[model samples]
Target: MQSVAKIRLADALVKIMEKEGIKYIFGHPGEQILPVYQALRKSSIKHVLMRHEQSAAHAADGYARASLQPSVCIASGGPGALNMTMGVATAYKDSVPLLIITGDVSSNLKGENVFQNIDVNAVFKPITLQSHLIDDPDQGIEIIKKTFQSLKTGKTGPIHLNIPRDILQKEINPSLLDESVEINIKTHWKDINQVKRLLRKSEKPLLLVGAGVLWSHAAGDVKSFAEQHQIPVATTYPARGVIRENHPLSLGLLGTRGTQRANYAGKNSDLILAIGCRLSERTQKGLGNAPIIQVNLDKTVLKGNINIQADVKEFMEKISPTSTKNTEKWLHELQSYNKVHKIRTNYDKTPLKPQMAIKEILDGIGSSILVNDAGSHTTWITLLMEVSEPSSLIFSGGFGPMGYGIPAAIGVSLARPDKNVVVVVGDGGFQMTSQEMATICELGLPIMICLINNQSLGIIRQWQELYYGGAFQVKLENPDFVKLATAYHLKAKMVDSPSEVLAAVENGLKLNKPLLIEIKVDKNEDIPLPK
Candidate 1:
């Protein structure tokens, strides 16, 4: 740890981050951050330059998700900070670790009509773990350290920091620097006995995994607990693949656009171990009847939609001893469901059985990161894919924003080059951030792109067909994603029939480079899910 003497605030900022082990900074620089930028240039931290401030935030979010660490993004005042909000909110909703560092107007000019100024703290408060502004030069290190410490404590999310232009450039006076507190404080889970009791008494238990498991790198623990007790795992959109989808214990996603298996598992379960996730309506289908054994870091989140409560890690650590294991009676039932589903899939003749396609991929890939963009594709992909490891599946669950998956996957790839990044995106959704193909190509990140090309905004079209008499305007023929990939100089392939699923899965991941496999599924196909 660098000793903080009364020094330049930017100097203190760099030293504090270095001590916190922050190696990479993602953002675009502006006049407000010039002092910090100059200091950063002299530091070992590598800054990734992005085309847009929002992209920078997404990149930072990606770094955090992929690396499983608090990733940082720096932006200028006003517009830069606002743009950064997109990714900040994404991190907030997804429960990803991110530090959003924004340059603010000078303290004196903050409430005045200064150029490029913003109320960064006020704007980012809701989306952050903590919102702080660096006012005095001497308070820099303590503030930085405290911010990171606060973020790591409970239900960690995005943390925002506003560094004023003038203060960052100011010299700190000696005797004011103090680093007395530890920054790695984490809380204990709530209702340990209650959660364990629920798990123990559950006749049919459902283990719901979210991005928090990934954030905590607790997939191994979750998998062990689920498998040991034969509990079925249901994934949130952002938490797909945390349990290997085909794992007898894994039931894929539940809710409005989920699989029959997932829906049944959740609905029928007597106990729902909603670990590290706030059971949202999209995952719960408005039925919060099952007793939810909620174990999370934040006690405040205990007031969930269901009767769930507590910090998961704390509960598990204390309750694992009290909890009995070696129960596999229910595994037989899950296996029976899997077999029946498979046999029925072979017999069914739908235009495109999304479940079948998903089953194929889940069966084929043992370990890979799956990113699902918003719209109908998000639901379809969730219904199909399974992740055995935490952080393997990524999504914009809260925003449900279209065109978020592809770029996020790109970010994930940058963060986890060792792991394979596979994006399951629809034609319309893919069109939103398809420009990321160039980023993938330039970065040389190997990711498999499963472009479900139905030639329409399938989700809205599904709604329109159901309610609007099939009047389609914006949901018409889509531009060729294959051509788009080709234009980006990335590998491209087309799959028109079910016969192509296996081969595409094989070659797409085999390319060992970025590739787009466009699957033109039947438009009439439906994702059987909870209402």
Candidate 2:
């Protein structure tokens, strides 16, 4: 290595981050991370001081989801790191790529009950693709580079780096850092002829796009493949915007709160070309016997009837969609089913239904990115919202976190400043991270929050009504949301009836500022899942 000027390890790490185009680092300051804070302050990377460490992680997640790039979040030792576990687990389950950095006790204090010290590496093992404790300051840049490279290689998820305070404060030679290391990923192709033969053989074929398409940036290729083959496409929650939901051959979302049309199409398909998706429980139902051609970046995820372990984009690119077979009859059958399974969204009710409110919101907002929190409202959006482009809709998936929408929307707004960013949340979930409204005010970013003020945990209450004989503890009393927004110096309104929803949403969108529209929905108005 060439001899170069020496700098503090923390500064060297921040320098490498700047080299990699990391514009921001979401985190909280602490005693152990003081060096990191000082280094970041001097460098070009701006650190967002979050209200809580959990929000820091979620912000990183939302940023990565919208930007399609790996994001970084930092936290202090022990309690701070523990606080980040929920957000880390949320990203792990959803397969979002995030780099989590946590401060730790000094190397000399290992296992000595040091203040704010815990087994950070062991705690994050289950939730991260890789977890390491930096014992030597010299290895910091290499480790950071390796972590970043690993996330971009194949199956993407969260990774943890626990840097001891002593190590971060140690001096390191700048020339020792490998700043030019590039991510080299290659997909080993299997036999494509057999997959092609199967595609040609099938009468009714359905292309199931998953989160992998978003990771691989293959939405365009997937769209072209579907259009050329004239195949109906169904998506998982993370893959909602793989294609325009308004496309003629689109089947919207599949599984959980999936559209009746999408579910029906999946059930009837003779062959399923599942690309970049893990055919998990949310997207897979009653398709056990169907011949599945599963394509994924991770080979382990391809455990279907027929599996292809290659880069999703490369695999999709090689597949010829120019099928000579005339499958108009099969396409017609799925399209007919789609028409028959159309959901009713124009109900005129006093205390507005969730579906009706969602319909108006979708109709009112034109081509804007939608972010949703996990709750009964998520089901409504998955079923009702028609998303067309990738990165258009982001939500907590496998983890189903309650407080994700508000902060994640803030992150999304930061990433997608050119597009209008909207968030939908239930009253129960909104309060969990409603404090982020303050974050929005501080940043001065215009975000529209559609709060479904249903006076209970709607999903839990519905389950209790159905199974637990109308059990209790689900009812909630909310502070006047309009007042809540006003306290934060934000524009807010409350809509009481379905008739008033569109006008309220229209007015909020027209404001072009931080606006919250709290729709007072009936507690008893529950949408049972489609049969």
Best by lDDT: 2
What's the TM for model 2?
0.95
lDDT of 1 at 318: 59
lDDT tens digits, residue span 443-479, model 1: 7789888877777776676677778998477455667
Off by over 4 Å in 1: 1-6, 173-178, 182-206, 227-235, 257-265, 268-270, 286-290, 304-310, 323-366, 476-511, 516-530
Most TM-score-accurate candidate: 2
TM-score of 1: 0.83
Model 2 misplaced regions, further than 4 Å: 1-3, 179-188, 286-288, 321-324, 339-344, 347-349
Error of 2 at 442 (Å): 0.4
Per-structure clash totals for the candidates: 12, 1
